[model samples]
Target: MAFDWSVEQIAAAPSITPPTLHKHYFRERKPRAEVRFRVEAKLFTVLMTETEARNVSTIDKYVKHFERHDACVPKSA
Candidate 1:
């Protein structure tokens, strides 16, 4: 699923800021699998990537994201 919302609305909804720093809401009943990594810096950052369970092999689903980030971008299909 794809979601696009404004920061203004997210901030007002719920969070941990003066007005509350709420960003997004994607409450899945159960996540099929997950992959997490850490970025070392002044402060460590955790990146959690996930996908839901499906009967067939969704290679395309995973393939598209290979271009989603600069680090994961592929040269050719």
Candidate 2:
């Protein structure tokens, strides 16, 4: 007999991994923009892991949130 799938089971699978402290050390100097983006992404990844909310929609929300608020201030040329 085949096992039947349930709504609860499918919904429970949020595809979230536990937040592991990922520290990347850079020996050489790098561009400010690149470094800033990496740091932001890493922090976002950690938060997602902790919350167990890894869906694309949720991630997109965080990215937008950063762009609107937490991200670096733009410098007018």
Candidate 3:
């Protein structure tokens, strides 16, 4: 989903100042699944790189931890 709200649109909303909007809700929200997928893709790339470079041992713990995280984090509605 996309908000597609411009700064002017946000600031023009009832009782909302640009500074207030920025300080409180500047960043757009993303779904948990999207975030997880991006993270998994990046991690997979790094894992493959490390394996090819013979440095997989260095990130073994991280791979295990990320696997656990993937198993535990639920998809957002």
TM-score of each: 0.21, 0.35, 0.51
Q: What is the Cα-based TM-score of model 3?
A: 0.51
User: Judged by lDDT against the true structure, how good is candidate 1?
Assistant: 0.32
User: Per-residue lDDT tens digits of candidate 3, residues 1-77?
Assistant: 22234566757865788788778774543554565577678878888888889896757976788667657655553
| Per-residue lDDT value at 59 in model 1 | 41
Candidate 2, residue 66: CA error in Å? 6.4
Model 1 compared with the native: what TM-score? 0.21
lDDT, residue 18, model 3? 76
Residue 76 of candidate 2: its Cα lDDT? 42
Ten residues in sequence with the least summed lDDT for candidate 2:
16-25
**lDDT tens digits, residues 1-77, model 2?**
00122334423344322221112223322555565677777876777785686466766676687666534454540
Once model 2 is optimally superposed onto the true structure by TM-score, how far is the C-alpha of residue 47 displaced, in angstroms? 1.2
Candidate number achieving the greatest TM-score relative to the actual structure: 3
User: lDDT value for candidate 3?
Assistant: 0.65
Query: Per-residue lDDT for 7-76 in model 1, tens only?
Result: 4544444543423342233442122222112111211211112223331334444444433643543445
Each candidate structure's count of clashing pairs? 0, 0, 0
